[model samples]
Target: MTLYARYSELLDTVLDTLQADGTLPDGIERRAVAVEPPRDPAHGDLATNAAMVLAKQARTNPRALAEAIAPGLEALPDVSSVEIAGPGFINLRLTDDAWRGELATILREGDSYGRSDAGGNERVNIEYVSANPTGPLHLGHCRGAVVGDALARVLEAAGFRVTKEYYVNDAGGQVDTLARSVHLRYREALGADIGEIPEGMYPGDYLVPIGTSLAAEFGDEYAEAPESEWLELFRTRAVAAMLDFIRHDLATLGIHHDVFASEAALQAEGAVDAGLERLRSKGLIYEGVLEAPKGQTPEDWEPVELTLFKSTEFGDDQDRPMKKSDGSWTYFGSDAAYHLRKAESADHLVNIWGADHAGTVKRVQSAVKALTDGRVDLDVKLVQMVRLFRAGEPVKMSKRGGTFVTLADMVEEVGKDVVRFIMLTRRADAPLDFDFAKVVEASKDNPVFYVQYAHARVRSLVRKAADAGVSLDAPADLSLLDAEELALVKLAAQYPRTVESAAMAHEPHRIAFYLYDLAAAFHALWNRGNDDPGRRFLVDDNPELSRARLELALGIGQIIRSGLDLMGVEAAEEMR
Candidate 1:
């Protein structure tokens, strides 16, 4: 167990003892009590607000309650001291043996050091990068892909049964455009002069190979077929090819999905109609005319009666229409059916979308709530825009002009590790600037390089110890470690808590930030040796001390590796 968890368990034991002795009231809810790292390290190793939380309920003075609880915590085996501070907070300083035991646990657990059961084996479905099956994935789709994939890994480490999912929007009008583009290419391949891909058709050269494959399969067979006869055939082939291209792009960035749910297949199976009927049976669906949107009204806007869902009853700003004026199902209708199908099996649903879809979140959430009857919970994370730069100048990319930077392009320019790590330097809701010049620099400004450098430095230390014949089999004399060394261990000890918190919050960026902090701590210790020879890991006259220090270094390396694995990043053994 992590030291923080151990301390929390001790605090709980104290609370139980207080209640049993009648000093505290029985059945006092302890859920709000938190044992966490103190805001100021000078205060203590850990701090708790148990006294403040229970004082009112127990009908006692806050500081007096803290004073009463302090003795019980101070008497615990692992706690070295406990002090009651301002406003009923209790600060704790743990024994050196406690930090040593945590290091031993780290060496024993290795890559599984931070794994936890906080999720309690709940099933979570994460759906992301559901881009339209039109062309190659562009910069717009990159952040959500990386964020969703990393969050899945984080939740898995926190003991959730996670399913990584991708939704294929193949039933949309964009796919029809893809089919037409492919047909144009097919005609061009058959010696027909299909002029400059007329406006509104995909013009990326990535489709040239698909056109060649089509020509090879049926010589002029589809070249002459009318629109009705060839639309479905071309649509099927185009979507399949685009999905393969998308899969390859995702592979380059080290992303894989367990399920790829198809909107077209759901619509084909009458799932949308059945879902609507279920809502209709519950009187949640009605035919109504919606008011004009509040902002600038479209010139073509006109009131029309359509099938609407009673989304406003569930906190949406207004009732949402489920069908278009032409009587065809809308995108929200298809997504509602898709979510209903997902909610049937999963206890939790998470969708990662771009910020452009922010306005649709409430209606989609309302739809899921109505469909599932509050049985399953849904969370939608919106990833903001990413602007790519080389040096300081902006990299202009556009999918319409066929000049957009694709995911494959970025991965090729920089390595997959660089792409993944830099994408997570900021939170999902914050705009990120990926500068080619800065991310590759060997400086602290480049988080990936800084963290990887720390890992590589530890590996180098281990090799030096091995070369000097330092025996690692001996148990470490952790008591010899001073304040600086213990500070490093304290930072490493926060890994499990960070994992649990990041997983619960559905934010994978926290793991990235934690790893960077750990790397900084490790680097600080390494740099300290330069000024004080005794602080160095290698000592000519004291092999025992050298071995102990090496053990500490190895434990830190283990944490870096574990945290990197959670982010789907590689821990480098050597820097290039």
Candidate 2:
């Protein structure tokens, strides 16, 4: 029922014909061959990379291979023409009927048009926005969270078994600092006048709830104890409180993770030790000293011996230390083991990280390679900065003094839907500018509102059509649809193919852009009707044309619904 996907079957048929006709070399691998939209629309509706991919292995000129592939394709029903352009790309132009038939499929499949099985139920783990438990998530974490969540949704739509995960940095110096901050709050909760927060203590008032709860539960007993007595327990309580607040903030944007892996748990059962031993068996662990890292050489850059992981054995610039001189594991040490643990259960691993950790990419990937010995694929997506704005003015930050905005604060101001949709309007690696004023406007400039408006418009069209007594026969004549009506139908048919591409490329922003384009096309068609009375969705005494156009509009509406669902944006039947 998926129009674009069905063409892939036709593509397979062409390959089979080539093999059977003895035109192509024997033992051709079909898996490497792909069908996609040509970058230049003038080339064709779709282009395949098969010719170039098979050229080296088959020992044949790519153009000749493309020539052989074209004849087989030209014989297909939907393929109007197949041309070999520049190198060996095979371009296919579908017939008008072929494009028109896509609308039929949209009505049949509804919102599920673009779902693909490219993943074949394989297990995929996506770790993202593993922000520290120290404070509320802010604009820094927003883009990665939206990107990761949307990517998981797209992958699942493509038939992959995806697990959304959050790695909590609970057992670390940050958490210890968090404990000290709460101890201050605990003292304040007992009505003590705590002076200005110490230089090293966390200054956020977020931990006040933890203190108030402690006083209510354990009473003055724990309050009277020394710092050591309540620090760990308070740290645990504060982290739980922080996580709950974080999860609630994420839910506002409809984000959810299947797993919440704690770094402490990896250390609890000696999993970190076990992971290091596995690397040791592979001759990838040793005790040594590392050279000074890039940029500033720490004043304490004395060449000191420590147990180091042989990340250099894979691709790291230098051996990285697993333990500092004092015997405590460094952040990189826990991260290496964490990835190893993930690699064990996934066919593929994807981690979404903040821009600040760009340097950590090589070490984590190296550890993953060491653990899986290159069997598992690991991809780390680094998110660039977000330039938060409101009506063209830059938003300032330094929220420790209340200068910046928190994630919850943004959601509270703009609402969750606007915040999520605007975040995805740009790629994760590219810098994104989120404007609070622009995103919530009802005008066409707001992509989120524009796309949602298309849905609401279509929904209203369907209800009006029914009220006008339009009845669709058992099988309407699709060929009778006008050119404008047919064009909208063709757009509806491409939903499935778009989903497949977005997932395969690991690009969720593509979905956002695609939905905007689809919405634009549909809206343009609607406005055309308004400009020409005869072509309007509701024409006077032209029941047949109106019925035909209504069906086309319905198909477009269904596709818009499907695309918005994939992007985790609501397909509003009506907008506020």
Candidate 3:
């Protein structure tokens, strides 16, 4: 358990004592009680709102309830003093030994320091980066990929059984266009002058290899055949080839999904029909003409009867369609079915989609809730776009990607670690500016370099300590650490809570924000030695103090490595 968790348990015991002695009421819910660091460090090490939240239930004012709880808290061995400030908030200053014990725990746990079982091994299925197979993954898909993958890592660290998934939209109209585009390329490969790529086809040259392979395999058998003879065959081959291309690009950035569910396979096996039938049995599906979109008159709109799902009953703005007038499933219908299939195996479902899909979130969420009879919940995280720049100038589109900068392009230029770390520097729903010159720059403004440099400095301290004959292998007397050094331990000890909170909120960007603050504190300590030689991590006269300081530095480095591992970034040991 972490220092904070240990104290939280103690606070619970104190509350229990109050109830046992008839000072407070019995059977009151204590779930609202929280023990955390005070807003201001000067207030105290820890503060709790047990009185503030329980005052009403206790039939007393907050101050009166606080008066009853203070003595119980003061009796704890680790607490040196307890003060009630402003509106009956109870703050406690822990003994220095308490902080020292936490530092020792950091060294003892090492890489496993921040890991926890807060998730209780619940099954969570996260589907992300399900880009269409028509082209390479662009910058729009990159942000969602990083956010989803990092979230998976964080959830696993918090003890959830996570399944990383990718949904292939191979059964869509775009893949048909892809087949036509590849057929044109195949004709060009067969010594035919197909001229420039037409207006409606994929214009990138990435498909040239797939066409060439088809020409080399089948010769001219399908070259002169009609579209009916080879459209499905070519679409199958083209989508498979594009999936391979996508997998290679995703692997470059260290992303690999555990499950790749195919929309085409789902439809081929009649899952969509089965899912719709289940909804029909629940009275959520029916053949009805949707009213004209809001703000339009009935005379101006042509309404057609279609198979619709009662999405509005479950909180959606309007009912959603399951099939078109032509009796084919709409995109939302297929997606809803896919979610139903996923929910059958997992306890919870999460979708990471681009911001462009924000309008569809409510409908899909309602579909999941209705389909599962309120048994499962769906969380949709919408990722904003990433704009690329080169030295402050807007970057031109990639020729290979046809319109946008490809994921492979970004990963190849700035490296995988830099790409992963910088992508998360902002919230996933906020626009991010990525400059080639800025991300690779070795400056404090760059979080990737700043965090990595802190870890590298810790490693450099070890090498310097070895050369100066300062032994670090001996047991560290943590009591030798002063207030300045112990302050760092206080910051590093929040890692466990940080992981648990970030995982619970489904916000992986919190880890990035926390790492930057921790690194800043460490750098401030490293810079302190420049003014006084005695403050240096390696003391020429007092080797014992030097070893204790080294222990502090190593503990910080261990935390940095663990956070970077969760982000899928490497901790640099040395800088060039």
Q: RMSD of each candidate?
A: 1.3, 2.1, 1.5
Q: Flag clash pairs in model 2.
A: 114-496
Q: Which stretches of candidate 3 lie over 4 Å from their true place?
A: 296-300, 398-403
Q: After superposing candidate 2, which stretches have Cα over 4 Å from the reference?
A: 49-60, 86-88, 293-299
The digit string of per-residue lDDT tens for model 2 on 123-220 reads 88999989998888888898889899989999999989998999999989889998888877887898988898888777877778878887788777
Structural similarity to truth (TM-score) of each candidate: 0.98, 0.94, 0.98
List model 1 lDDT by residue over 148-240, tens digit each: 999999999999999899999999899899999999988888889987888999999988888888988998987888899889988999999
Per-residue lDDT tens digits of candidate 3, residues 61-156? Answer: 999999999998999988999999988899999899988888888989988899988889999999999999999988889899999999999999
At residue 217, what lDDT does model 3 achieve? 92
Which consecutive 10 residues in model 3 have the weakest lDDT in total? 396-405
For residue 547, model 1's alpha carbon misses the true position, in angstroms, by 0.9
Worst 10 residues of 1 by lDDT: 1-10
**What local distance difference test score does each model get?**
0.91, 0.82, 0.92
